[model samples]
Target chain A: METKELQEIASLLRFEAVRMVYEGGDGHPGPALSSADIVTALYFDILKIDPANPDWADRDRFILSKGHACPIWYAALNERGYFQPKVEHFHLRQLHSEFQGHPSMKNTRGIDMTTGSLGNGIAIGAGMAIAAKATGKDYYTYVICGDGELQEGLCWEGANMAAGRGLDNLIVFIDKNGYQSYKTVDYTVGRNNPAERFMAFGWDVQEIDGHNFDEIKAAVAAAKQNKGKPSCIVCNCVKGKGVSYMENNNNWHKGVPTKEQFALAARELRGISL
Target chain B: MRAFSGSREAFAAALLDMAEYDERVMVISADSLKAMRAVPFGEQYPNRYVECGIAEQCAVDVAAGMASCGLIPFVGTYCGFLTMRACEQLRTFIGYTHLNAKFVGFNAGLLGGEREGVTHQFYEDIGIVATMPGIQIFTPADPAQCYHAIRMAAEVEGPVYVRAGSGREVSVYGNDAPFATSGITVWKRYGTDALLLSNGFVLDRVLAAAELLSQREIHVTVADINILYGDDASEILREMAAANLVVTVEDHNINGGLGSYISKLACENRPVRVHRIALTSYGESGPANELADAYGFSPEAIAQAVAAARTQQ
Candidate 1:
């Protein structure tokens, strides 16, 4: 797919993800919006997956280490025809729905690991990459983590292990949106460079504009071709991309849009369509 | 059952055998392979083994992740660390996620490094794991049973918690000894005057108790209640109705172990007088046999509890 097509799909995914959250009345829309483009590129262009054969042994595995952004993942999966997009099931925690507050492996299709507790996804992705290498399976493992979740000790544990083991098949993307659940990245953890940090951990690091399809594709390609070391793509993203009212706003971290706000956000996201 | 061996060795060999047959079999350890007797499997399949180095939480989450990618992950760790230390991750990642991960809790019950004191002894592990929904809890009676249980765990889907006892040379079952996940085994039956239900390390002692009771014309029925998760209500109730008394035994605390489950079963179903023989409190540093005696988990202790219960009536 062309760069323009990927961006358009990302916009569509962003619009759908926001709409799902708005309609579902609860979710982490900010992270979902922040990660929309990368998720779009991976699901549409990078990953070697058959939506029909979700359990395909040779298919590339994707783990949403920041699982709270599952609204976006579910939207992408729905768009990819993994299942019929049931917008109603979004944010259905403990309600026996496929779309839970966190990404659950049992409830959803295309969800490789059920992750809500942060810092767990990277370790799991490393395990997957190791398994692939051990079993001689030609498949890559991609893990998308929150910038704030980088504070977790386990991520570094996995990062160290992955680099030490030389799991070149594993690729980690840090959504470097400068905001956390409570405050901005600077206010919360004080100036920390994800790229340099990952580089120090022996990962081949690349800093990219998360929303830019070309940059994401190039970085992903580089990661896939790279050998002997795990790759880290530090993506600079807006907390709430496309929605002016919510963009870069900390309040929208997990707050559901009101009916009026939802309408306005939807109209703005869809442009002339609404 | 033809795979007659010691429990720890049998579990290790069975895991290796499973890994040899299935490339997806992966074992993660918290630097306790020698203690867990998983060194053989680790040596045989180096790529399949992960040494997580004393991090139980990492071991659990990593296993959950490995299991997510179609790998049959057996997390080998001391029962105390696996249960008490990294329990939340186990509940969330393994139990809640329903991953195909088996937690091989080595040195379960008072069978752990008993000389290391209360911290290493995992007397409450079975009770804790059994409470988690969707996790199949297994406690193999002997080495032969452990082999079958480990093999069967691989075939069974979803998360499994196998409480592996330490290398204590208890009486091994015959070569023909059969095992199943949900079924309780009747190890010995002597006219059903009373039913002595037990699991794991307490099985031999319960058998001994039943044998001793038989000489006193008590005619006790000894049951190896290996499956400790569910109530085993129907089986217990039937035995309670048939027998004059119901006595439960375990190398665990009286609060939530096999005895508690059997007591609940007896109370709800048959309404019989139930006698529980188990550890009443945390243990101290000593030999396993001495600790068992101090904590009232010895064969004589179980027998005396049953005799006392019988005499009360």
Candidate 2:
């Protein structure tokens, strides 16, 4: 896929994610929008996934470690034909719907692990990578985490274990949107570059603009070429992107846009329709 | 019989046996190999063992991760820390996800480290874990039973919690004992004047009380309940309904342990009177025997509670 086509798909995903949040009356749209391009590039262009065979042993595994931003993930999965998208039942807790508040392996299709509590999905992804190596299967496991989620002690434990074991099949991406639930990353961890820190921890670090499809695809391709050590891609993204009213706003982390604002955001994403 | 041994030793031995047969068997410890007695397995299969170092929460979460990758991870930690300290991780990562992780909680039910006070004592671990959905809870009485239970838990799919007693050795089941996930075992048979139901290290005390009561013409029957969570209450209620009295003893808190479950089962099934003998509250620092006596968890206390209940009738 070309860079322009990927960018168009990402814009559509962002619009759908925001529309789902508005319709469902609850969601974390900021991180979802921030992660829209990366998820879109992976699902559409990069990942070797077959929607018909969700449990294909050699298929690439993607885990949303910061799982609250599941609207964009659901949008990608639905676009990739994993399941039908239900806009009305997106964020309802515990309902017998296609999507859950957090991804559940038991309830949702195409979800590898159920993740909501911070700092657990990466560990599970590491396990998947280790399992693939142990079982002699050729596959890669990709885990995406929030910049704020790095504050958890378990994430470092998992990172150290993955690096120490030389899990080349594993790749970690951090959505460095620079904000957490309560405050900004500067207020939380105080200006530590995630790529440099991961590189210090013995990872092959790649810093890229999260909204740029060409950069994301290139980094992902580079990560696959490198072997013998895990790769960490630090994606620099705005908290909320594309929509002018919600861009870089922390309040949209889990906020639902009003009906009027939702129409305006949809129009901005559509952009005069060719 | 292969001599008397503790549950921790049996668990370690069984884990080694599984590792010898299956390369996918992995054991992760929270720097408690000496405490959980997995040194033998670690010595033999160093590659399959992970020493996660003093963090029970991280230990359990790592085990869950390992399990997700198709390795059967046996997490070894003390009962107090594994259940209480890392409860959220256990509930979300393992229990809710129904992962294939076996959580072996050593020193359960105040059996070991009695002098370590309330910090080390875990009186409600079994009850607390039993409440979680899709968890199989097992409290073995002796070494042989622990061996069978551990092997079964590892081979079986889904999450399991094996609450093991301390180093106090006892001989109850022989090598021929059957160990199933949800089955209960009967220890001694009497004419059924009264029935004594027990689990964990207190099973020996219940047997001693039964022997004493039998000599005194009480004719008590003893049942060693290994599977406490979601036990077949119908069979127990039928047996209790026929008996003149039912007494339950355990080295655990009175609220959520075997005694509480028996009391609730008896009241709901039949209108039979039941007597409970267990620790009423938190324990103090003291020797094992002294704490057992102070907390009313000894054989003498079981006999007294039964005798007092009989007198009141």
Candidate 3:
């Protein structure tokens, strides 16, 4: 797919995600918006997955380890026809809905694993990669982790194991959206470079602009070309990308925008900033 | 299934059988390959065996990862480390996700103190995992039962936590010991004066105590329960109703174990006096017999508790 096409889909997804947060009256829009572009690239171009037969044994596995940012994931899955739903019409966090506040493998079809709690998806994703090796399957496992999610001790423990095992089949993309749940990742943990840590842990590391479609595609291509070790693409992202007021704003981490604010966010996503 | 010197070896034996029949069955150890007597399994199928090198949380999440795919991974490690250190990891990844995985917790109780010290021993494991839904808690009696329990756990579709003893656990059951995926087992039947309920390797002493009580004319009905939680309440409730009083014996802490579990049931359902004989404090490093004596779980101690149950009622 062309970069322009991917960018258009991503903008649509960002608007849809923000609208879900507004309609649901509760959600983390910051994460959802931040992860939109890369999420779009994976669902639209990168991932080798069959939407009709989601349980295919050889499907490339994708785990949203930073699960709170799942509105973007849901929008992409809905757009890719993983399930029957008009992406703009469905309730976001409704009770018993397939698309819960966070992703649940038991509930959703395209969801490879359940995640809401931080630091779990990466480790679980590593396991899936190891499984690919065990079964001699060509399917790669992609994991999207939050930079703030790195504060969890288990993430490092998992990284060490995956690196030691030389899980070249695994590719981790750190959504470096600066702001975390409470504050900025740099302010909360002191040191901010997730790429350096991944390098120290022996993973093949790369840094890229998360919202850039070309950067995401190139980074993924480089990750696949590289061998013998796992890859970590630290994606520098705005907390709320594309939207005028919400971009780089931490207050949007978990909130529903007003009618006027929501209208403005939607317009900005359509390249009609007014 | 033949009994080995310990429950861990017997469990490993059963794991080997599981792996032989099913190509997807694998072992994930936290640097306890030698401790679990799984060096043989590792040697036989190096591709299937994953040694995470002393990280319990890492091993468990990795096993969850493998389970998410088509593989069934058995994680072998110390009970406390697996239960305490990686409690959240187990609850979220394996428990809430309802993954098809088996956790073989070695050094389950104060009896594990004989191996190392209190650090290796875990008396609070049953209590901890009992709260997590979808996790089947199997506290098998001995090596023979551990063998069957591991086999049964492998058959379970979701998360199953089978607690095993350290390498020195004595085999009380015969080669063909009866094991349940979920239910209680009657180890012996003398009378309904008292129901002797116990789980884990301490069942050896519990059976002996039942024998001594029978000889003393204090006749009690002894039962060994493998499923600590998530059992059909009817059979156990029937056994509880048959007895005048229930005597709980285990090599675990006084709270959150068989004693506490049964007491909760008895208090709510049956009108019977409950007598608990379990570890009162953290485990002490010593010989198994001495630790048993010190913690009030010796054969004589269990028998005396049964005898004294008449006064409590």
Candidate 4:
């Protein structure tokens, strides 16, 4: 698909994510909006997935490691026709809801791994990638880790494993959205250069603007072409990328937008006066 | 029967046996390959064997990820580390998802004492894993039974935790021993005066005590309660009910190991005096048998407990 077509779909997914958070009454809309474009770009372009046949043996595996940002993921999966009722009517985090607070591979189709806890995705994705290699299957594993989630020791543990095992089939994208739950990454981890850290671990590094569809496309292409070592594409994104009121605002990390704020967010995403 | 070196060797041999036909079978470790005695598996199928450095959580998550891809991965590590350190990973990813993964916790009971004191001596492993649903635990009698338990873990579908030793376990069952997938297996049945239940490597002591008690005319039906967790063990519960007195012998802690299970069963279902003979505290650096003896896990301790229980009744 063209960049224009992808951007349109991404905007629609962003609106769906914001709406789900507003309706669910509790969710992290900031991180969801921060990761919206990357999520859209992967599902629509980068991933070798079959929404119709989710359990296809050779399909590329994607793990949403920063699982608090699941509204965006639910939006992508729902829009891609993985399951029923669509993103708008979904009962997120409800009793027996497919759209759980964190993504579950068991409850939701198209969810490759269950993640909510910050640091599990990279190791799990590495496992999947190694499994594919062991079985002589041609499939890649892509994992998206939150910038703050990198504080978890398992992320480094997994990064070291991927690099050590020569897991070229694995590609990790760090959603370096500046801000975490309470503050920005700079305020906590000091500069928080995810690309340099992954490179030090011997990974092929590509630092890019996360919201740019073209940059995401190019990094993913470079990552796919790189051999021997695993790749890490640091996606420098805004905490609340598309929403004017939410962008770079740490309060929106888990804050559910009020009626007026939701209207403003809706208008911003839809590019119209709500 | 050919006397195997240790339960750790049986642990490796079983994986070798499974790999003959099942290509999906592989060993994933957190840099404890030698400790697990899985060097042979790694040597045989180097491609399948994965060493995730020293990260226990990564090893388990790798297993969960591999299990999701239809590969049966047996993650091996220290008993205390695997069950405690990567506990959330086990409970959340493997247990909650009900992934087809196997875990062999080496240096169980006091077997790890000689290596490095209390840090390695893990008696709370069974209790920790038992709290999580969808996981079946097996504290096999000895090396032979550990083989059958590890083999059975591969046969079954869901998650299985096989408690093994640091090459210190004595062989209990014969070469042709038939291990039931789940439930208790009676190793010796002299009488029902006092039903003696045991698990893990300490069953050797229980059987010896059973023989000594039999000589003293205090006959008891000795059973190795190897398969600790299953959906139904009513037949064994009925046996426990028939006996006037029940005693559980183990090398693990009395709080949450075999003793606790038998006590809970007798307390809720059938009221009986469940005498527990197991470790009450951690061990210091010593030989496996000396640690076992200090912990009152010797054959004499079992006999003494039985004699005391018999006199009380």
The TM-scores of all predictions, comma-separated, are 0.92, 0.92, 0.97, 0.97
lDDT at residue A159 of model 3 (Cα atoms): 91
Q: Write the per-residue lDDT of candidate 3 for residues B8-79, one digit (tens) a residue.
A: 888778878778789889999889888898888999999999878778888988998899898999998888
State the C-alpha lDDT per candidate.
Answer: 0.81, 0.80, 0.86, 0.88
Ranking by lDDT: 4, 3, 1, 2
Clashes in model 1: which pairs?
none
Cα lDDT for residue B236, candidate 4: 77
Runs with alpha carbons beyond 4 Å of true place in candidate 2: A84-94, A189-193, A196-204, A222-229, A272-274, B1-5, B180-182, B284-287
Write one digit per residue (lDDT tens) for candidate 2, span B1-313: 2333678888888887777778888888778998888898889887677766666776777777667667898888888799988787789889998999999887776666587888888888877887788888887777787888888888778999888877764667776687744455677887677788887777787888888777777777888777775646566666677777878788778778787777787778787777877777788778777778677866777777777778777
Provide the DockQ value for model 2: 0.50
Model 1 off-target regions past 4 Å? A84-96, B1-5, B180-182, B211-217, B230-237
User: How good is the docking of model 4, by CAPRI class?
Assistant: high
Give each prediction's DockQ, rounded to 2 decimals: 0.57, 0.50, 0.78, 0.87
* Candidate 4: stretches off by over 4 Å: A85-87, A272-274, B1-4, B311-313
lDDT score, candidate 4, position B277: 87
- Model 3 stretches with alpha carbons more than 4 Å out: A271-274, B1-3, B267-269
lDDT of 3 at B306: 80
Model 2 per-residue lDDT at B235: 62
Residue B250 lDDT in candidate 1: 78
Instruction: Please report, as a residue range, the 10-residue window in candidate 1 chain A with the lowest summed lDDT.
Output: A85-94
The residue pairs that clash in candidate 4, if any, are none
